[model samples]
Target: MPAALHPDFLRLPVAHRAWHDRAAGRPENSRAAIRAAVAAGYAIEIDLQPSAENRPMVFHDYDLKRLTGRPGKINAFTADELAATRLIDAEDGIPSFAEVLEIVAGRVPLLVEIKDQDGAMGPDTRGFEAEVAAALGTYAGPLAVMSFNPHAVAAFHAARPDIAVGLTTSSYRPTDWVFLPAAACDALREIADYDRVGASFISHEHDDLARPRVAELKAAGAGILCWTIRSTEAEAAARMVAHNVTFEGYRALIPG
Candidate 1:
């Protein structure tokens, strides 16, 4: 049997992007948002991607237009340049992964999502995973890493076997990845390579939890988690199947 996942990770309500509320000046992955989650005693989830300087920055989009209102890719700017570009509707700018970790400071557990760089996913591809590992080298707290790409999970697991890792799954549609061939999209959607990736947990799409594979994984004791829960009904339904949730949009109705 695989190793049992830490119970603390399965019990806490994970704040997706740190309780971000743009109107409140707390943007997703911003310092203020992370602090809010910490105060609420909820675990925090953040996204990591490298800037031009190879420093891991805490952000979500590949392009800067959506959040930063800048006309360029996130990697086009150095860490300092990214930090100086203000996030819309908030005073905070893009934060370095190290800075976000410091702000959390073990106040709550963390779930780090490694964003995919275009279509690159293999271990021999970009070194974003290594950069993330290095940034997190000294973080002495409850934390786990996850990604939509199985290769990303595998790369991290190979480097830091001690740190728990997970795979994010969704029922893929052709529109989801127009560049990929149908077979490739099918493989990703089915999570067919999960066993080979050595992931300790599964952060699946809430709607996709009814799949037989998800139930089997849960019964076999792989930690069952789900993401992007935004409403009370969705949270309630997801909790019925998944052990814990990654939530955002309105306050989460935590499972009893």
Candidate 2:
């Protein structure tokens, strides 16, 4: 599939895990959370993983115990099996990727992060790339795919160069590469490589917000996005310091 023309993701502070409220509704990647984000007029970022039957669903953890109280890996159960499992404390249930895209249709853009192998890209990781690409074919709104694994992003780009891809890294490491403790040289090298390979944006942890290295990347025209900010103060700080901010559980912090 060709990459679709994406809108400017820099416009709004994206909600990293949707607007999740465990007590009032489901948490991240649940249907309720995605809906809440749409209602709040914020874009959302979500993780995509497949079920045992090769169905794509909105979820984060590899195991089901944390969210569903089920004792197994997400890939161990079919979509039907997952649907039968109750999501902890929410009135709504786990949602398939198709369902999520349908509900949020044309409301807000989604930054779909493919959780790569142990936070790095390697062959041992499951083939989430193919499933994600397949599911995305059904989507009709603005969307971008991001991953900490360059290989994952590379694979997705290879499959669909038209879709905007964001390469995620942490300041704890260098931005040039996707691995931990990435060297500065590696960051520069990778930025060039990603550009040559067609990545549209770059996302890094907030800890790297004020670093000179971040400014360097931004100067080079890599669309910058900072993540996992959980407080209003942090969001404010990010807005003052970064190009785009991704906050988890703090949609209310964004001014209407």
Candidate 3:
């Protein structure tokens, strides 16, 4: 049998990259945004990027140019060095996964996505799974880990069997992902890796929730989670198929 997502995770809206509001000075994945998500009583979603030391950092991009305005790969820096670097708008530093756990302190459920280190989403996982398992050893929280790469998810599940694992699915629209070759997208579109990776859930692209494969997964008892919802209409649409939503940009409604 596949692992399962805990019930609490489906009860509330998950803040995508935390409750980020750059105009309000809480940039995505910043400590301030995560804190705000906790205070607002929403589940928090974050991404993990490996650092120079192979430690997991709470970051979205492999490169620092966009978020930090610095011109190097995030992995080029050690944990301390990355933490010292500030996000452009908020002046908050890039925090490690360990630091994020401290900030969240298990206040709400966490949804963590492990960024693919190798561009191919291939089998070379860089031991990030084991590294994250080590970091999460002491965190007694309601959380789950997922990745776009099946290999990474499988690796993580092996190392941390107690934690739930899932796949971050996509519609595999070619224009949307220029870097991913069309063949790769086509292969991933079918979600053939779902069972192989022991994934019990999938966080799929919001616009593609109506995909037949998504419904099939749900019927097979897989949890259905949706991503990057930014409007109430979209939220309602996603809720039609999703157990819950990972949202950003606007406040999401919690069910009564």
Candidate 4:
């Protein structure tokens, strides 16, 4: 793996969300947030979703009520509609994935979580993944693609093996959240299966890092990345325990 995509994420602590300080101009998934992360010397990880017209945009939620105060589904709005919507974090404009890429350039590696809910891909998504790949073609920095939907990750990896792919899970979802289901195995078998799927890393909620399955992942040549860590001290503690990298709400951890 390239230094940028190294299995060991310990080199730079990742911020889960972009440095979106509502008071400062940093809005999650906005170009401003990406710029802030670059200025702070921290790598960035962001979420991608297709707008109504199938254009790729930087956003994390399926609904727009929280960020935009506009009650509607993200996929229900066209790019122009989304563009017209302002981030509730002080009138910051929502940014396109391309715009964010331009701002960050190669300043820091990026981990993109592609939205593949319900198997929506290709033309159904206006070829969002292909567009993302095209945008990334202009970037020289390290890049990794991830998804909670295995099919999405598989599709991206099959198309572009050059970029590493990670599989993410959360404790809340009983079905897909757990990599290995009881039918597969009651124990650590799920982690092993995910590794078999060519996943370079396992990104899970911070709490999941404590499950006994983590050791199984380590043994399978996979790395551990915990998500949404908000505090520096919590990050330190997680690193000491099981996580090799952390996404703490968009702030990259700069080593002292």
- Expressed as tens digits, the lDDT of each residue in 1-256 for candidate 4 is 4112453254566655666676676667776777877788776788988887767788999899998889989989988888889987655667888877778786777778988655422124345666667667657666677876665666667667787888775554436435345543332225544644468787777766777676676675666777778776767777765545555443544667
Best candidate (score: lDDT): 3
Cα lDDT, all candidates: 0.83, 0.74, 0.92, 0.68
lDDT of 1 by residue, 60-99 (tens): 9889998878899898899999989999987868999999
Instruction: For each candidate, give its TM-score against the true structure.
Output: 0.94, 0.85, 0.97, 0.82
Q: Which 10 successive residues of model 3 have the least lDDT summed?
A: 1-10
Candidate number with the higher lDDT (2 or 3): 3
For the record, the alpha-carbon RMSD of candidate 1 to the native fold, in angstroms, is: 1.8
- Tens-digit lDDT track for model 2 on 110-225? 88888765443544546678777887785667889988777778877877776888777664444445444445435533444455546767787777677775677678666788
Global CA lDDT of candidate 2, please? Answer: 0.74
Listing every candidate in turn, what is its Cα RMSD in Å to the true structure after a full C-alpha superposition? Answer: 1.8, 3.8, 1.0, 4.1
Show where candidate 1 strays beyond 4 Å: 1-4, 118-124, 253-256
Q: Give per-residue CA lDDT, model 3, range 1-256, as digits (tens).
A: 7667888789989999999999989999999999999999999999999999999999999899999999999989999999999997886699999989998998899999999977888889889999999999779888999999999999999998888999999998999879988999999999999999889899999999999999999999899999889999999888999999999988987778
Model 2 segments beyond 4 Å from truth? Answer: 1-8, 118-120, 172-193, 253-256
lDDT of 3 at 113: 96
In model 4, what are the clashing residue pairs, if there are any?
Answer: 15-250, 15-251, 16-247, 16-248, 16-249, 16-250, 17-249, 17-250, 20-26, 180-190
Clashing pairs in 3: none
